[model samples]
Target: MGLRQDLRRGIRLVKDVMRNRKAQGKLAEALAAQPPLEPHHYRVGVYFADGKVNLYQMRQWYKPLAELSKRHPVLVLSRASGAALAMLRESPLPVAYVRRVVDLERVIHEQDLHVVFYVNQNAKNFQMMRYGRRWHVFINHGESDKMYMTTNQFKAYDYALIAGDAARARLEKVLWDYDFDKRAIPIGRPQADHYSGTLPYTPDERTVVLYAPTWEGDRGAAAYGSIASHGVALVTALLATGRHRVVYRPHPRSGVVDHEYGVANRAIIDAIAAVNAADPGARHVYDDGPELGWQLSAADVAIVDISAMVYDRLAAGKPLLITRPANPAAVIDTSGYLGACEWLNAAPDPATGADAGASMLARVSEVAEDPEARARLGYWVERYFGDTTPGATTARFHDAIDHLMAEWERFAALHADDEEVDDHDEEGEADEDELG
Candidate 1:
């Protein structure tokens, strides 16, 4: 058994190496075909080091970054070949493939990068943060109440563009002696302003339900995934109801840590396919596409776990249900919106022996029609995102960037006479292979 496992691992490793090499070739060819980026053209830089697997982190920002580029030219400095290749094909903004430390330095030297944005807390982000004179800002992928939202890693950046009052309050409770007024800027959810993606199905009388669950976490504390516990049952119940259309968008990293979780996720997807086959007009979608906005906006009700999806749906200010984690060990932070939000449990009813799906249907119906629930949701929306008025968040986002740009100029003039220092030491540089 050990021998077989080792052989399988070796084969998988070989396949990964071959795939990466192919992607790198494609990236090189693509770059060679395009016009070389002009020197000092971009003022704003988005540094992403994660590969294709985590592209969702970057995909959500496409529209906002494209819009931001209109005023201040934006560039994406991709550190992974696969990510660079993918972004080069689809990203609205120009992409610079900086796979090695030396390549990264070249982009830094060329671009007048006044503000650099980070989407996630990828360890490789530190590689980009080491440079001085530019604002290393953390504009995270999404807004959420997960423990990840309050990590001490926030202190590492020059500033964090947070969501709103709730995020500030949440950070204050945990991060000690942090200068919130100076370091944290609330721009609301700028992505919310530009919710892209067209509707896959036409408008109908059927209630649309978007069930976007997070991945099975790497640890028990973060085990908020409901795909294994609540997903199959709830999705099944919704499909059985001819009046409902289920839009299942599971996290991109779903089931990476657990086999059973992957099985359940597949089951939900298969059920959607089968239901659609049986009724072509049902239009129950199993969306794994890069676009995210339409599902959030079109769905009559959304069911999400304890991850960023909860906050993403909340930003829509629509009626939604938060799936209660089946894992008792799963940590729940109720200090913010979770404390007062509606919850959907996986437990079955003793009287009816009904599964999670049946209960979910009832909950979905209740939330969809409840005026009181809508009112409550409205309050939380304002608390987390400030003004959901169209273009409001986008304006705030641009304002924040303008503020940082002005500050950069102020500091630049203050130390104009100081000797220029080269922070990129040869000893500190990692090998090209080490970057991946």
Candidate 2:
């Protein structure tokens, strides 16, 4: 890793330490004052809520559980995810919001939860599920190629939901080798169900092209160009059409803590801001989460680099485009400085379009207007969504939560009301807030 990457990892580690310390302290106090009861008979707690819609693939797996709420009182866990879920509830579904993982655990024990479901497990999320909750269910985030994932991911849920047979096969192939066969369920993405149901009150009318770039990393947008370069090279050509709405959606990590200034790289973010403000057809949308159906609804096609938006766009079977640079040997990464646009489509560069001003509009326009080209893209979407049965696959994702809830019950039965002394080896104050 580069120095900046090393520093970033260090900073994240420091934050993790602080989180655990605070939660541990609270756990001790709660143990000392709680009642002992068998957890086999407890409520179920589901940890999820909606994120932004433009980010399609990453909605916290809450919508499907909407079905589960009819049978039981479901506890929805989140930080600001609650706000996103308000509209989703539509005046139904008994929901409780716990802002942190520690809060979830405490609530799980107190409520005697029978199962706990976790969807979208990234590196940090994996660390959050170590509570030995009796049964854990997982709804996986899929990959581009339907193949086995690295074993460290969340295949350990009592069951899992996959988008389709291909997704199931891919998930099973990767996980069973690690003995997670008994813990997976092949199902579809529930959020996909979300879009079909209701249209928001005031939807943007123009062909909304959601331009979401991944965060800065070894191979992310920050390396290529600031918001300006991407805007000029990719977004601008389309905006010049004066008939499209280009939504500049950056990765969820593009927050104040990520960049030096709250704004993205000055050159690029400034360009995007200017373009968005200047053109009625373009505007940048900041994320609260990766829930992006509203934006996706407005889109005729989604243009992305190596972001999940590509796969999510396929969920809608909408037209999608991925950018590739003309040159293969023009990529770079530095310690703290933003890198260069090295993330090119490695295939021999296509001569159909140019990355400069006018050429982009021509090539993209041809693709947008061509029904055959779009059909080819739809084929790609089918390959990605893989799930033929939506309800079944959604259950697979919820299965994990049920198991986790069950585990919480067993844990409460075993570790009720007991005191333990501290054996700390760190010196930072508690930061339990970030767990959401």
Candidate 3:
């Protein structure tokens, strides 16, 4: 029996390798076909080690990196293989894969990298941290009020590119010894400026409601996801109205932590599909695409979980509802928009019992038409994001980059003396050797 199990495992491993061989071949081809990278080719490098599983965390950086490339040569640096490598291939920005520490050092030197940005706090990041000259900036994937946003690990980076004052305040509260004033830079949300994407449905008189729920988090405090408790209830209520256009965009990691939550999410999606099929002209959407701006901008009202999606929609100054986490222990930061934003709480856990959607319909209807809720959005938008004028956020983002570049130059200049001294000592040693 043991021998048979071993044989089966070995066979499965072989089959897996064979299945991935084509993707591996494609990656090799792409790498070989890459144009010769000259010394000082890229100024900025976004280091992401999360791979394909957490690709969503890296996707938000695409548009911002694309725009930054226009001003300074920007490239994505990855050491991920297989699925991660395959996903990197599809990225809009140029990518360089370095597996070994020595290879990473070579790229850093050859590219004359001025700044390195990190999206997540992967332990592998410490490998890149060895390079002391370049500025390591922590530009997290999304902005949210979750405990993950204000982690102690934040102090690891030389600098952190935050969304706005709210982020700065969060860090200030948590990081006791760190210098918040000098290190934390408020660039606002750059992704918002590049909010250009195709909308599947045309503008109409129907109320377009975007229901974007985050995944059921791994821990209890982070378990703020509303898909199981509120998603079906809210979505069904809206669809039943017959005057609403529902757009369901569940987190990619939905059901990953909890299978039951995933089942609930799928049920809501299937319900939306059924609604669309019944009324062909309803144009209900199931957005599983990389594009986020279209949904945030197109929706008349957004029903989102207590996550970054809430803030992103807040930036649009739309009538948005934050689903109160069903978990009583969910941690919520009251320092920012979350404190003032309107909330919709579903009772009796929509996942259990009959006529679940009925109870939440009235609340959804009331919040959807609340003029007061719409009015309060502007004040919070400006407070959280600061100045929603046409290009204000983008300009602030560029300004932050410019400040960092100038600072890097000064830092390099100050450190150049030490480098020169080392060079002189080596030269003197060579002269002594020649004399001997």
Candidate lDDT values, in order: 0.89, 0.49, 0.79
Runs in model 1 deviating more than 4 A are: 1-11, 427-430, 433-436
Q: Put down candidate 3 lDDT per residue, 159-210, tens digits, no spaces.
A: 9988887788877888888988888888878878866688898778898888
Q: What is the TM-score of each candidate against the true structure?
A: 0.96, 0.62, 0.87
Off by over 4 Å in 2: 1-42, 47-59, 77-105, 120-133, 141-151, 172-181, 196-206, 218-229, 255-291, 325-355, 387-436
lDDT per residue as tens, model 1, 23-79: 878888999988989998999999998988899999999999999999999999998
Best by TM-score: 1
Error of 3 at 397 (Å): 1.1
How many pairs of residues collide in each model? Answer: 1, 36, 0
Arrange candidates, best lDDT first: 1, 3, 2
lDDT of 2 at 136: 55
lDDT of 2 by residue, 372-414 (tens): 7566654445554555345644565456445545556677678
lDDT: the better of candidates 1 and 2? 1
What would you estimate as the lDDT of candidate 1? 0.89
lDDT of 2 at 397: 46
